[model samples]
Target: MAESATALAIMGMALVTYLTRVGGLFLAGRLPTGRRWRAALTAMPGVILVSLVAPLVLGAGVAEAMGAMVVLALARRVALPVVVVAGIVVVAVGRAWLTG
Candidate 1:
């Protein structure tokens, strides 16, 4: 009985969390976040991209990550696809070199 009760409690908490995340999708259309919020939302992608990539470049503290960043910087003046390929190549080489 105690085990079942604990399981039920955990299940309930998981359900609540799932609902909260999904609920936002439904409720978002109704919310009037206004012009400022809309403008901020437009900028969110770049913000999120930086948020994700910045940590990888700075916090990863690995040779591959540093090499990738350098390649990425060079690619900026050249082309985006070039930068992406450079990153992949750098990572693959670094991993193989470091591991083997």
Candidate 2:
């Protein structure tokens, strides 16, 4: 694609992202602030994370499975940053060991 077309595509994506964020904020402001809603909102991140990771875990090879196991084991004990780094390292090392 031409430079102008690429720039336009990027701008379009940015606009869409910004609009979605604004729409979410607008919707959130209108939502009920009840206890059930609060609880659901609190759990939303974990639910979303599982939804995203479930597919990868189900389809993964040994290396990815092992990495996911490590992450799960450390999730409650360690901070998120630690868990993330450990997961990445585990997957990288496992892949190397398996394929080497």
lDDT of 1 by residue, 1-100 (tens): 8999999999999999999989978986787789998988789889999998777777775765757666868874878777777777777777788878
TM-score of each: 0.52, 0.66
- Over 4 Å off, model 2: 31-43, 78-82
In model 1, which residue pairs have backbone atoms overlapping below 3 Å? none
Worst 10 residues of 1 by lDDT: 61-70
Model 1 stretches astray by more than 4 angstroms: 1-13, 70-89, 92-100
* lDDT of candidates 1 onward, in order: 0.80, 0.92
Residue pairs in candidate 2 whose N, alpha carbon or C atoms collide under 3 angstroms = none
